[model samples]
Target: MKTTLVLAMTADGKIADVTKSPPTFGSDRDYAHMVEQILLADVVLVGSGTLLDGNESSEVREPDRALIQARIDRGQTPQPPQIICSRSGKIDPQLPFFSQPIERWLLTTKKGSLDWIERASFGRVLVCETADGSDIDWQAVKVKLAELGVENICFLGGSELAASLFAADFIDELWLTICPFIYGGSAAPSPVSGVGFTSDLAPRLRLLSVDRVEQELFLHYQVEKKSEDIPPT
Candidate 1:
């Protein structure tokens, strides 16, 4: 399956205010555009934090949810199958999201020791392999998602997952929204990705388009590994 990683950051490159939370610390337009792209996606790979914090079908508003619902009504489940990438299956069992009328898949490395909550039957528990050939076993993840019939995966990643994907070269494209704001706290959280920094001294991105909405500026970049980006792993 092809993956598109979507993110919203500030002009100074900050995703959170260093607190690991949101407002996305940006402009309204950034949020709007990000939400719009998410609605169009066939599969929304949710980050564990987003799920644990109680996001529901209604959280994604008009036009977006409306567009998604139209597909659901047309015999195409519009909720886009929330595939939660959880390291450990510790989400609240009775969370309204689990009961929401949508297809949910929880991809975890373990079939965690949660006995009170029976999630095995509610959704698919994907077990990810830890290794692959000299290559980074992209197959394990791809094959499993393909088995679930996922074609386009829109990754709603937190920092850690975003870093891992970028390092693994698992991301095909990136749609980043750079909000116009400078969070100058020495410890302010960055809105930018972490992968491109470690492997290669420099990250490469092709400028796609730039849009200004309200008080924010949205910049889109395509991330790809170049000859110089490959590290001596």
Candidate 2:
């Protein structure tokens, strides 16, 4: 599946403030842009941190008539399913996310899926782990997503998840909205957070387009991948 990492970061490259509070910096235009991207996706992917911190439903709120009609014409459900990635699967069942109208799915490890399996909170619970059992095997994840008919995925992240996908070379594109503010603390988190990559091994990108609206700048990039890195059909 083609995966796009969509994020809004501050001018100083922080997605969140030092306290890691919910993001409220993106402009109205940025929000519209996000909705547009989400509409193009077959499913939306998010890290558990985003669900816990944002405390918001993944549904497209207040979609315009045209957007709603477009999905109907495409024979897609009005709302896309949201698949949350959590290695621990320890989210509180009472979060507003559970009550949302959209279909909910969970991607976790064997041990992590036990509680969710019993609670029956998620419509589908997928257990995929690495050989060492340290993290999700993203290579396997790609195959599973394809098997489930997920052609396009919109990844709304909370840093760590973005880092993992990028490191694994599974991210195909990026839509980054650079906000006007600057949250310049060391504790502040950027779009991709984890152990930093070395220059030689870092993923490369080709600039696709840029749009400036007021103080915010929307940038699009295509991630360059080696032929060998791409998985076979």
Candidate 3:
């Protein structure tokens, strides 16, 4: 029932260069490490922006590697579930991922998206009511994931969703790939889109490990609230 956020960023502190593209700006070794984590997860979650692949967000291919094969060896059929958070259900209908009846979960707050959810009912889409009793309480999304038997969740993060999960105090760990250069200007997006929202205020992180691939640095932090560890700035 633990949530882990996995992301790759640049040393300039940019998750996306300037276009919000992903699985990019990483070294070969870093990519290998990412595969290892994906293989160990019980569910892979991403943002709708990521799958959309517009001029704002770039395309990312499905990860296929030895870890998936190992999952099969361990009797984990198919693969870990794929969870996408789309407020508008604007995801591409033509995505090849929809071609199969795989276990894919979508989280949305729109009542109109119900039809889209039904259209994708071949998969599972949850139309959730908000926390104020008015809209979707996305903070409960992972709670639902846990109830559905998810043990490990790898959030292939961009920024917005990661910020939300952080605010929700659901993220237990973080895998950040820090590159060697800065690209974005004053207008560029910050690595994490969090602002004004902090559940475990002054949150703390325990550096689980670190790896250096060429000039890039991979920082893995175990998220511990102030009760568990000293909070950071």
Best by TM-score: 2
lDDT, candidate 1, equals 0.64
- Which of 1 and 2 is ahead in TM-score? 2
Tell me the tens digit of each residue's lDDT in model 2 across 1-63: 799988899999998899988889999899888988988899999999999997765578765
Question: Could you say which candidate leads in lDDT?
Answer: 2
How far residue 148's Cα lies from its native spot in candidate 3, in Å, is 1.5
Alpha-carbon deviation at 119 in model 1, angstroms: 2.7
lDDT tens digits, residue span 140-218, model 1: 8788778767777888777666766766767777887766677666566554444347544445666678877776666
Clashing pairs in 2: none
Q: Cα miss at 232, model 3 (Å)?
A: 11
What would the C-alpha RMSD of candidate 1 be, to one decimal place?
A: 4.8
Identify the runs in model 3 with alpha carbons over 4 angstroms from their true place: 19-23, 54-65, 96-102, 110-112, 132-135, 196-200, 231-233
Residue 140 C-alpha lDDT in model 3: 69
> Each model's TM-score?
0.77, 0.94, 0.82
Q: Residue by residue across 1-233, what tens digits does model 3's lDDT show? A: 77778777666677665554443667777777776776687777777766665322211235664566788887774466677777666667667666544577777766626657548442677666575445457556756766777788888765777777766677889888887766766555664675744563755688989877679888989888545755564
Which regions of candidate 1 are displaced past 4 Å?
53-66, 69-75, 94-96, 111-117, 120-122, 131-138, 192-196, 199-203, 226-233
Each prediction's whole-model lDDT (CA): 0.64, 0.88, 0.68
